[model samples]
Each structure stands twice: as C-alpha cells, then as structure tokens.
Target: MSELLDNTEAATKAVVDWLTKKAKTKSKFYIKDFYKIFPDDKPRAIKKVVNKMVETGELEFWSSGSTTMYGLKGGGIQHSSEGES
Candidate 1:
C-alpha cells in the first residue's frame, strides 16, 4: 500500500465535495465509508477532516439507530432523535 499523501486542505475539500454530491440525492454517509473513498489518507485522519467539516458546517451529521450519518446542510434529512420512540 502506498503511504498516505494528501494535503490537509485538499483532503478536506475532497471530502466536502464528495458529501456534496451525495447530498444532491439526499444520501447519508458515514465516516468509515468516507475512508474508503479517500483511501489516500488514514482512517483517523479522514475522521478528523470529517469532524472538522461538521464543526465548520460544511457538513451536517445526525445519529440514526446508533449509527452516525452525515448529509449536506439543507438536504432535508432528519435525525433518529426526531419523534422516535
């Protein structure tokens, strides 16, 4: 396997852009799944980028049946916490 070789800023953009595409279809994604797309970076590193994206509002996340999923802001996706019993 090649060494992880991606600039932090570029990696961040790649992740955000990928999620943006998914958002167009109102699709949800997980951090682990993202690592598969951006395999150039380590899983932990990808996680940091994802978390930062959420923190800065580039992406929005919510829990679903114990799984955390992320979607683009204004994508109209709701969380598991909403009126679930």
Candidate 2:
C-alpha cells in the first residue's frame, strides 16, 4: 500500500490507510495533503472523493478559522474538539 497513489479510487484506500495510522494517534490532516499525494490524478477528483469520505463518515471534517482539516472518525476523533483547539 506504499505505492504512489494514481487515482481517486485508489486514493480512497490510501486516505483510509493514512487515517488509520492517524486514528491511532487521533491526529488530523489536511485536504491539500491528500491532493498532493496523487500527482497524476486530478485535484478536483481527489477532493471529490475526500468529500465523499466525509459524507460517509469515514473522515471527520474540522474547520478552524479559515482552515479545514480531515481526520479519521474510526479513531474516535472529534471534529468539534479539533476545531476548538
């Protein structure tokens, strides 16, 4: 699963895997970070999939000021807590 991500579909798994790791630490990550992973994939497509993840509750969305971050809900992370801090 360490291979470079090439598509949004593959990226969905990669995001889940990455978030799985973060789930252990309850760490949050950013949308741009996800976008940068798939250099060949369209940025819009990546964002769309990530949004889907959020919609499906795979990833939690946290908004801090003007910044929005995403983290794994599977890890028991809280979006409200993330934004408050």
Q: Best candidate, TM-score-wise?
A: 1
lDDT by residue (tens digit), candidate 1, 15-58: 76777766666667777879776766677777777788788887
Q: Count backbone overlaps in model 2.
A: 0
Point to the candidate with the largest lDDT: 2
Give lDDT: candidate 2, residue 30: 77
| lDDT of model number 2 | 0.70
Clashes of each: 0, 0
Task: Point out the worst 10-residue segment of candidate 1 by lDDT.
Answer: 1-10
Residue runs of model 1 more than 4 Å from their true location after superposition: 1-6, 24-26, 79-85
What candidate 2 gets wrong by more than 4 Å, as runs, is 1-9, 22-26, 74-85
How high is the CA lDDT of each candidate model?
0.69, 0.70
lDDT by residue (25-51, candidate 2, tens digit) is 656777777765566667677787788
Error of 2 at 85 (Å): 13
